[model samples]
Target: MIIVGKVIPFVNRKRELSSLNNFFNSDRAELIVIYGRRRIGKTELIKEAIKGQKAAYFFVEQALEKDNLDSFKEIISKTIDNPLIAKADFTWEELFQQIAKEEKLIIILDEFPNLITENKTLLSKFQKIWDEILKNTTIKLILCGSSISMMESYLLDHKSPLYGRRTGQLFIMPLKAGYILDFGVDSIEDAIRVFGITDGIPEYIKDVCYRLNSGERLEEVFQQDKVLFAEAEVLIKSELRDPTRYFKILKAIAFGNTKFGEIANYTEFPAPTVSKYLSNLINLHIVNESYPVLVDKERTRNRRYHLSDNYFDFYFRFIYPNKSEIISTDRISGFEADYNRYLGRIFEKVSEEFLKLNTDMLPFRFNRKGRWWFRDKEIDIVALNDNTREILFVECKWSSLNQNDVKHILELLKQKSGHLRWNNDNRIEHFGIIAKKIQDKETFRAQGFVAFDLDDF
Candidate 1:
């Protein structure tokens, strides 16, 4: 009675699947913790991993403890072919003891935070259960949740009772840019457009794909009454106690207030308050704090915050700001030009993903890659191999570039590379450009420059 749920077209989680399968096939008991933002496909990945195995998948709901326990009992009875389980009222530890009796089984408690929220002592109880009963058995226990904060504080944090109990942990991330093409995007340009909004999140990509297939204009998907119009607000409210404050902070960052002082001034919050809120958002992976590439993070005072979640960035930038207009008029006015400009940044991210996937295209394999900036100068992409003193500087453009334009950009990039203080004298320098379209790309390549366009993606 191990039900394999309806299968969807799984895309691009090869490493995760392999790790999960290895844990499933292992000789020892496994306590695996999987967590990510909502709709990032944690449950689907778990279901896909446990396919054809003796597994019981119980979605933990927010309810009374006894009510949830009864639901878990029912699932267990059907999964293990034991009618007595349906009749007996068992505690969490007792139920886990019964699960351990099986020779081999996978127990996936989806939304595990719900369980811990109802009964905080469940952490200590589960810790005891694992140590006393299930630790010696062949049970592959998977605890999954969407509340990244709760999951980390309750299960993954060093101070928690369940700390040191997890045999493995997987932080499920969104699919990279290349996977967007698998969703029936007609071209890399269309894919980049989709990626700018969805950020390669599988569920969001599916929604965009459906709308595209149904002939809905891309902008129309974010119109009033659409699925994603208010999704960012909803997700923020669900995850944080103070959504309004976080929304202000996120909006500030999305609108190019990346520096700490600027975000504080824009949000009108005290500096200390801003730091605390930013820390919380960073823990949830909604905000990303980054330093220049190859810079010593601890030593450098230069850092910037960005909305790492693309959908959130799009929401704050476009949907949230125009909610009133969209509701009244059913359209966004004057967004096309700004959206295209936003795609310039998104295309840079897409280009970075492309570089990661095609590292062989570079002159030397790079150990580190990221944006580099100092005062007035910035490079779109900088990749370097510290061991070999090899460096690559690249520019990303969302518009088509002809030969002259390409040369100008490469020349500017080379000049800016002079500012990066990483082994400047001994470094072997390389230059590259990625754009929407580049004319005569081979001609540039023959001159020892790395150049690519949408066609290469």
Candidate 2:
């Protein structure tokens, strides 16, 4: 846990790091696949794992087969301290075989999809080499990629040559607000703002952390030409063949078009096409579909499409609309109206996490929890203590609510909870409110209600 130099120490990757690190001491050969969207820190995690150990990391890129072969030849040559190795031509299998002969190598092929894309047969080739040669060796092979769709289809699928070949696989994900905050931010408030933008992608967290440390303004953080600004654009272009159509669908969803018909109408794409695009987005972890919490799968028509993470939501909400504004002005004009409401919605998610973290405060342990809605009214946090026949209903307000304000909200919750109809005749009920800050929060608790503020979170 001691910092030796400039290393930021990977955050929220303890489990992953441990899995990879254990490879160093293992007595068997292994093939591990680590993948997710870009800037998700897969390469860094690999580097962290093999640090101070014998390892060869080749960052694969889109190029001719011979060119990539030569590139990796250089990497192997340097790692093995043999300049002569680079002077000769070697097939990838031969080069890998040579690398395996050198100590118990932690061999990482980053951007594995790039190699597969350029030569579709490379997957079968890898499978052949692994089964025939590498399987008997002590080398720990790790294939990593940012291409989620390709990685899933080409490696993890039952039809894939590499399927059932990997000893383990990790789908790296964005960090939660709490984990990112622990990594260091100005304050919890700034952490929330940063999460609103970065969604806890470590690379993005680093950028935001650096900017905040330098005392930069929000305007600069959101500048049109900033790295974070261009990230989504690049990702969209790479994953999507027709980025324009995908853009239209994504934009529509970000504009709060969650229903299939609404998104289809907004994007002017056919409903079937919209369904296909939404499925694609879901696969890419950009958007998700949610049904009312308590509804049966066969009976629900209220499925809502959600941009799966805060980063996408924030981008489509602010950056896409104000691209022109970003190009022209360096100043952020305001945080009024739409932006505030967006933050309010984000706060609901944040409060849910907060409630999850503070579960001990509940009167009973809840087995199921999610948003519940029927007709017009909705409860933001519904923690169902099913075994006890009780439900905790919470209303999340992004505004600063005084006890008086909270009391009225509570009255509304009472009316709203009556309609929940989840065995309501005999169900025990609990009520709560989560807000930016509650005036007289303790007093509300004394009044037999769960009330919390941002500080409590």
Candidate 3:
């Protein structure tokens, strides 16, 4: 079982932490909304932000509404040194009014969606409370939840009752690849391996770090009973009601059926059904649809669907297919070659992140970056500035490349660039390569090409 509150080192959320603290220090009342997928460190960031403050945190459980209210009252009573709060029976509005009596208070209702799910009327009720009672007070009311759809529909949507009432909203995202180094991994490659498995989710990274520091092999982290093995199913089931169909569609994409017709054929589902399911997955941020770089997504039919979360990508690609054998044998083996090929795709993602962080390596700062392809010709990484007509093409290889290999790959990249019709006449083109290791990388850099390796990471 995964342990809670294990004291993993918080790596990097400097901007988010600063934003929350600013809300805390504000003189007026604050209604903040915090949300993301499960185990993406929403709660940890809040805990860090409210470290020594006068805050009452209540994790709204999947229980009765009265039970959650009582729990909230108990927490607030203890936190604010008011025994009267626990003794008095009050509604959510009354409870907030009682809490608002204290100066500069922070009231956190985590899993706020659970409360709304149990009692749908709470949305308008809370809206009334905010407008009538809490708006004039100094209480910082925070509503956080893991249910992205529910949160967006009830709190953020324009037609919702709580619309236009929030002082600020934070949609927390996963950490980037570079932050993996802070987890005590020995090298950049090790960090990438961890990133491929954990997808920069802080809790999963902590679990992997704990296991690795305890002398366990990284492969052992994927054992049948481990949290990582079953996390994808839990996330999907929590978000989607009919998860079986979604699973088939996700597996289809995982197994290389990315096109609309390809997924429909593989799953044997109708085109419209596949479209609806893919839309749901896209909304949850579990899958992403992409067109070639510089192509308008709406105007193009040449789009492909891919898993957005790295852990989900790795899980569906490897674990879901061989789950029975892994469960029976209690180990994973004989997939190193295939796993390395999977890492090649992951390396492309890492290269994109690296280029974004180190944009000075490019000719001019790029405003757009993505994979580009036309017919059978594909460029791994592409960055462009529409205004300046500066474009960058990069090839990412998960294996080592010698001088000759780099030269050959650059030649192919240049040939493929001819197919791109963005600004063929006036576009200033640049080329580069990122790999596991590049021989004489400085030589390529001296030739005015962006060159990077694991050493640079």
Q: Best by lDDT, which number?
A: 3
Model 2, 31: alpha-carbon shift in Å? 1.2
Off by over 4 Å in 2: 1-8, 80-84, 331-333
What 10-residue stretch in candidate 1 is worst by lDDT?
A: 1-10
Residue lDDT tens for model 3, 246-349: 98899889888888999999999988899999999999899998989999888989999999878998888889888998999876677777877888888999
Q: What is the C-alpha local distance difference test score of candidate 3?
A: 0.90
Against the reference, the lDDT scores of all candidates come to: 0.90, 0.82, 0.90
TM-score of 1: 0.96
- Candidate 2, residue 393: the lDDT equals 92
Rank ordering of all candidates by TM-score, starting from the highest: 1, 3, 2
Residue range 1-457, candidate 1, lDDT tens digits: 1112323378879999999999999999999999998889899899888888999999999998899999999999999999999899788888888899997799999999998888899889999999999999999999999988889998899999999999999999999888877777767788888889999799998887887777777888888777788788877787899788998999999999999999999999999999999998998899999999988999987999999878999999988888899999888888788999999889889899899999887789999999999999999999989899998999999999999999899988988999899887898999999999999999999999999998887
> After superposition, which runs of candidate 1 have C-alpha atoms over 4 Å from their true positions?
1-8
Count clashes in each candidate, considering only residues at least 3 apart in sequence or on different chains: 0, 0, 0
Model 3 misplacement above 4 A: 1-7
> TM-scores of the models, in the given order?
0.96, 0.93, 0.96
